[model samples]
Target: MTQDYGFALARERGIALGPIGHRIVEENELTRVWEVRLAPGEELGFHIHYHPYYVVSLGGGDNEIETIFGKTIATQEPLGHTVYIDEKRAIHKLTNRSDQTYLSRLIEFKAVRWTYDDDPAQARPEAGEQTPEGYAAAFREILEHTADLPWEPKSLKGLYQKMLWRDEETGASIALIKFDKGVGIPNAHAHASNQFMYCLSGKYRYIPTGTTLVAGSFYCNPVGSVHGPTIADEATIFLEIYDGPHYPVQPPWYTDPKDAT
Candidate 1:
């Protein structure tokens, strides 16, 4: 004989279990990334999310999500997909309903300031247009199938990105970047914002850290931190969340061979 976990019981007792099946891959002033895996019939026990966050699905599968209000939503998440949830204090539980295991990367944003601005390059929805119903209504704000988003090429060759979410006021943005195999930029560059990178697939070497990062590895470079000249050993896909806009300053090593005056 076993006790059944029911919705009423969970709400009444406050769902004692908290974030099961999640491993902290990395953390910094700006973000915390968790690598999560749940086998069939496993659940990441009820937990509260106090900050804005995003989830990148590494393995697609069926799942059931129960909100603190006792509402349940079933979804079929796709691999490589990403979703963003606005900051709200909310509790929820997730259960893997598929026969296979479910894998995902959860990135939580901390210390974010939501200052609304009207920058043409920042294409996020207007604050007024966002849900006014609070955290309970934020369930509808989740974006799915992020891999289907269009890729925008940066100034760097052989590198492309898909901007997922951006906040003009805070200058925070989330993006998925792809690097072709053997793509190496010979520059020790730095950015104005803090950046956190999580390797979703493939392998690459971060020259500054002298570390070879593979799938599930993470790296953090704070504001004004100088690093890079990344070399990809294989086609690599990684998730990057930064505090401000990306403007990589060219280093002396990046000088053009044609301008050798």
Candidate 2:
């Protein structure tokens, strides 16, 4: 049996489709990771994007994106560039037009499947992880370059962050955080929703649980599960994501209201 992927309207509109990406490297309950690479003049045939997703550029190059509906775009992708797309278009394709190969890792949110419909409730926050809102009156498409974005200081000393994307209503967000060596969270804490992190570099440790994160480490902390009093053994950088609101109440570690998000 095949998944409906709920493309009734897309089919009715005569859109064609293909696989989501070039190659699947990993998949779990929450996400599917894809490695996308295209040599010069290579094209990815029409494909569907049925879930909310983001792309992390490993290497930058000129590329063109064409929708079956006929609109086309040509853009310069930058190294370390990131973008989040919430639109669930059923027909589109990309072609590498630069001299060098274009490489990226595209991650799709599988926990939430978005199908265009009129639903006001999706714009509202829920108790757990949320699905992408295809029906959102204004779903955002955020683009950022790690090298170009300035890191905002957190209230705590030696802590900083580059906010990539966020939901003002739900407090859900994705960010790149930095912790200087020896800097630490002074107390145990939990979050309002599941927290996910991928270490980009250096080492960080949870004192209470003795759990540690090193380069390439992946971590997940469940909602309301107490754990922390963490320290950076070395200067560290990590990508953090929250499935829903961040905290039941602002933790004392942060004095800046903006840091709470």
Candidate 3:
């Protein structure tokens, strides 16, 4: 399915073929998820990534990349290997050289130095009339190895997080959350903005809705909508995202705003 990931603004800026995927499967204020599939001997033509992007390889195979600068690089990654690329304004073409097809999901972080910042209409639409978070003086960057990122404690018991990226100015963030078995939010609550989640392993459930998320599941909770009283049915790890402030006011669970992050 063809979808716009700030493509309209890219075109307005004289960029014509900047898309990095065969199809964009999902997009919103926080991220654009692209599904890339390259059959043996096939190629994805020269494309540019305008924002920081991470890729999770599913069907890994022999692949080669040729940059606009004429550099050719060969690569092979095992299935489930993940990498984050903080390219310095790069452009390249990729080809699958192996007999087997290559498949992967590439997620472009829309909140990180987004291409449409000058136009508020194209920025986080859900941010709406609320104040956008302010930019911090410095934010950590993980160039290519996301597996090496360290996990930090959360104010909530039995929960931990690894912050992948964040837009300090917009309160937009992407994080990997791990919930220990038998632990979760103690009560129903709401978020200040939209929340997006993708389960990577194990299981969890929202008690009120009887909605459960397991490996490969995706969930979204819109702004101001109350839900939760959640529990981790098993030790769970999931990707969590937010498009704006986490809460209208700091929740009682967290005494330190730093821990809340």
Best by lDDT: 2
How far does residue 247 in candidate 1 sit from its true spot (Å)?
Answer: 3.3
Runs in model 2 with CA error above 4 Å?
1-49, 52-140
Question: For candidate 3, lDDT tens digit of each residue in 125-236?
Answer: 3544764454321132345365888878788888898888776766767799999999988878899876778899999999988999999886767679899899999999
Better of 1 and 2 by TM-score: 2
Q: Report RMSD for candidate 1.
A: 12.8
lDDT of candidate 1 at residue 104, scale 0 to 100: 76
| Model 1, span 1-261: residue lDDT tens | 422234345546765647633787655555666888989998887766645777877675899998766789998865655678885433578989999888877877665523212212223456777633343332335364885888776555677778786665555677888888988656777777657788999999977777787898766665686787779989898998775555544345434421111
Q: Considering TM-score, where higher is better, how would the candidates rank from best to worst?
A: 2, 3, 1
Best by TM-score: 2
If the candidates were sorted by their lDDT against the true structure, best first, what order would they fall in? 2, 3, 1
Question: By summed lDDT, which 10 consecutive residues of candidate 2 come out lowest?
Answer: 115-124
Q: Residue 194 in candidate 2 has what lDDT?
A: 61
Candidate 2 root-mean-square deviation in Å: 13.7
Q: Please give the lDDT score at residue 191 for candidate 1.
A: 75
